[model samples]
Target chain A: MEEVLRIEDLHKSFADLAVLKGIDLAVNRGETIVILGASGSGKSTLLRCVNFMEIPSSGRIVMNGRAVGRAVDGKQTYSEKELTRLRARVGMVFQHFNLFPHMTARENVMEGPRTVLKLDPAECARRADTYLDKVGLAWKADAHPSELSGGQQQRIAIARALAMEPEVMLFDEATSALDPELVGEVLGTMKELADEGMTMLIVTHELGFAYTVADRVLFLSEGRILEQGTPAEVLTYPTQEGTKNFLRGHGSFRLPEPQLD
Target chain B: MEHVWDFSALLNNKQLLLIGLRNTLILAAVCLGLGLFFGMLVGAARYSKKPLLYWPSTVFVEVFRNTPVLVQIMWFFFAFPIISPFDIDAFSAATLGLTLNTTAFSSEIYRAGIRSIERGQWEAGKALGMSYGEQLRRVILPQAVQRMLPAFMNRAVELLKMTSLASVIAYPELMYQAKIISTIEFNPIEMYTSVALMFFAIVFPLALLVQRFELKHKAR
Candidate 1:
């Protein structure tokens, strides 16, 4: 399959400390990939760099057959306009679902299409209404973001990103801010999007969601990918001692996948 | 006791008083519009990051706010004619003084309103692909503008009351007309009382409207 996104030799260092070290990865279209990690493993940094929200110190990022951030002797650089357009292609959903306060839920979704995509108002409103309905927030079209709960807000954020019709979506712990009951609504919305063949890269601790919903899962430890395979292989039958030890400590006796008969 | 109480002269000179009322109303509206434009600039400048913008705006506000409105009138009307190298009339001078006086207070009201908005609002605006100017115009300023309105209007009413002071500059506005009539008829008590009634008629209703608007905003 053609690569929808590719990164080579990625490195991000803040001051003296390195957060991402010479990483290479490619994502195929219509794939649901989960990046699993302990806190501070640089998964969030990696996702942020993909969206160009953080500048990579050294890397080459190619999206949709275009070279985005290229390496100059293993140092990263991009033209200002190139980076702006690249970010518009890949939408990032924050952990807190940072929706605009002055706008209603529908207006929030319509903004990108009207401003960036330059769609007409009537068409944009129709698109926003469809996306909001998909996220089960049609009833909340006129409501301000503050009026919604965390999960509803996160769903609206998802719809807002989806309204842009970007090639891929990045979720940086989308459900982490929600209450336990609220988490289900957001996950269900994401599941629907995944089922509809929207390419997604999610950083999550939800092993059950990763095992059942994700096509493949990459496990990271201390800024490195520790293990990667189909969830059936990694979650059910992890080969590396580091992966096993990490899961054993955090997973307890509950195996997310069913055991062999 | 009876000297101040007679309301007969005011009834006889209703035409003069009505014309004065029209001029006062128009003058207040024009000065307020001009003042708020300068006031928004002053408020933005006061919060500007650069020292030059901040210092000049600060000095302007302090000079106008600390000095009496009467001094501002005399300076613009009498002193500025010689210092300015051009002779502007009494009405124009009064307008300039009133605008500068009201600008000082309006700027402070706006500054306080802008400061109260949540920091997260800016972050959200930026994330939604809005540039800094758009964020200020479409998001921050609208909220600030609504919050600043009651205080802005109250200060405007004060500027209107202070317009009576414009009589000292020889502007033919409401109080000036009343003074001209009093001097002609030799009825200081009756004329001054009529002037007070004219001032009260405009300011009291406006004060009540502003109070109601403020209460509605608070309830919301």
Candidate 2:
């Protein structure tokens, strides 16, 4: 498998607090990596650094064989223009969906293409329609975010990201804000994307979705990866005591039986 | 003995009052346009993190906001011309005062409006790979402007009324014209009353528009 994204010794600190300490990761093309950690364990921070939302204190990030930030005296310096371009190629979805409330679903989907790619209106509209249809919200194209349910809005947000045609998509607790019944639709849409071999980096608390969908599950603890392996390995039999304790804390989750090869 | 109320004085001064009305609109329009435009810049500056921009903006906002606007107008009229290179007339003085005042107050409105939006919106924009300008113009401002509309209308109405303050410096706005007419015709009651009514005619419609906007926003 070709490595599409590589992070070397990523570190992020906010003032006196160290959030992520020396996290090294590599993501292959078409791989879906599910990050499981308790809140404040640096899970979201890791995902954020990948897209340069939160700049790493000291590290190297290589995406699609290109360096994200310039190396100056052993520290990474990012230009706004470079980061902006990087973000276009790396899409992200948020917990609240964060759809532009002023815009309709189709317009929200059209925004990235129009602004970033400078595509013509007709082409932007076409991409919007195609992506919205893929996410199964084509009929709700004209509806504002306030007019749609949480699930429907999230699906539109997905379409908005997909319209950018990103090399890898980052989902930052995409369905965590949804009502229990609404979670399935967003996850179902994600599952469909995974089946289509879209590269994704998801930071989530949904153990069941991770168990069934992830090619590799990583358990993070206090700004470091405690354990990582196939879903059956990490979810079923974690080696580290921290990973075991973390999984035990989530007692409500029941993992599905692993498929026999 | 009952006081005789005469109505002919106002009709006699109709042309003078119309000129006053015209001046009032010119002052309000000029100030409002310049205030809103500069207000956005000042607000963005105040919102900025760099001390070079932030401290100066904070000082500008605080000085204008804390002091009475009448003092600002009088200062521009009586005090500024001593050191000012340009000619200071009634119109220029009033325009400078009101425009700066409106800029200060409206800057706060812009700041608050922008702040009221969630951080998630900004993050979402950045995640989409949009530049700061793109994010602000395309994503942040569109939502913020909607929330800011009623406040801005309120500013416009207040600004219209505030134009009367120019009368202290003898600018030929509606209130100043009314003062002159009242003195000549000895009809202070009628003159002031007519002025009030005229202001209400202009301001009441704006007030209604604000309410409609609030209702629509709430419905959304």
Candidate 3:
């Protein structure tokens, strides 16, 4: 598989607090990478840096072999226009859903295509409906975010990001805010996308979903990847004491019993 | 003997009063329209990070807001034509003064509305690959403008009331017309009362509309 994203020697700092320290990562096409970490472990920051939402203090980020995102060289640092172009290929789903409250679900989906793609009105609407249906939101085409439940709103957000036709999707704890019952619906949508062979980088706490869906899982601790490997190796039998302790604290690492009744 | 209140004299001067009312409304409309347009630009500039744009916008808002509206009217009426290349009549002077004043107030309202929007909204727009202008026009402003309607309406009503200050320059607004009639007919109570009623007729309905909108938004 071809490399879709590469991060080298990435470091991020806010004042004296160093969030990311000399991290490196490479993502291949059609691969799902799940990052598991405790709070303040820089998992979210690393995802943010991948898309230049938070500029890395020092790094080289190459997307599809093109050097992009906060380059150290004055000539290489992308302009606002260039940054917008780069960002289009990398869609990000925020934790809060962040749907435009004033617009209907369909309009929210169409916003990027209409504005960035400069698509005609009919094309925009058609694509919006198509993507909304993909996320199981075709019935909610006319409903506003304020009128939708949290899960529905998040699903609509996913549809909106997909409308941009990004080659890679970054999910920042996408299901953390969802109610437990609603979490399944969102995770199911993600699983469907994964089955379709979408390249995704996800920061999440759902150990079961990570073990089931992620091609590879990375365990991060204190701004560094403490360990990374296949889910069975890392989750089922973690080599690092930190990873083992973290997983034990979260759960027994045993799958829940299925209800037959 | 009961003293009878007579309105015949004021009614006889109906044509003059109507002209005054028409002028006031036209002036208010022109000023409000131009003020809102200019105010959006000023508000955007205030929101910008560049000191070149932000400092100048801040100075403009402070200068106009801190001073008295009547003084601004007088300065534009008297000093503007003398110092500037263009000449202006009393009506233009009044209109310009009110527009500038309204722009300053409206800009602040716009600033507040824009600022009130969460930073997460902008982050979401950026993450979707939107340009700054696109994010502002599609995402930020739509949400901000809805929040601004009540405050904007309040400022508009205040602008309408401020038009009476134009009477100082003999612009023949309702108050000016009433002053002339009161001097000529010696009927201050009836003539001024009629002018007050005319203002009430125009403003009361607008206030009610704003109240209705506020209630509806609250329900949402």
For lDDT, the strongest prediction is: 2
Which segments of model 1 are wrong by more than 4 Å?
Answer: A6-25, A33-62, A65-87, A95-103, A142-147, A203-207, A215-261, B1-4, B42-68, B107-115
**A197 in model 3: Cα distance from truth in Å?**
0.4
Each prediction's TM-score versus the true structure: 0.79, 0.96, 0.95
Q: Which ten-residue region of model 1 chain A has the weakest summed lDDT?
A: A79-88
Q: Which CAPRI quality tier does the interface of model 2 achieve?
A: high
How far off is each candidate at the interface, as Cα RMSD in Å? 3.0, 0.6, 0.7
Model number with the top DockQ:
2
> Which candidate has the top score in TM-score?
2
For each candidate, report what fraction of the true interface contacts it reproduces: 0.11, 0.98, 0.80
Model 1: which residue pairs collide?
Answer: none
Please write out the lDDT profile of model 2 over residues B24-85, one tens digit for every residue: 99999999999999999999999899999999999999999999989999999999999988
Scanning candidate 2 chain B in windows of ten residues, the lowest lDDT window is: B1-10
Residue-wise C-alpha lDDT for candidate 3, range B31-94, written one tens digit per residue: 9999999999998899889999999999999999999999999999999999989998999999
The alpha-carbon deviation from the true structure for residue A225 of candidate 2, after best TM-score superposition, in angstroms, is 1.0
> Candidate 1 local accuracy as lDDT?
0.83
Candidate numbers, best TM-score first, in rank order: 2, 3, 1
lDDT of 1 by residue, A108-214 (tens): 89977776677888999889989999999999999999899999999999988888888889999999988999999988988888899888999988888998889
In terms of lDDT, the poorest run of 10 residues in model 3 chain B is B1-10
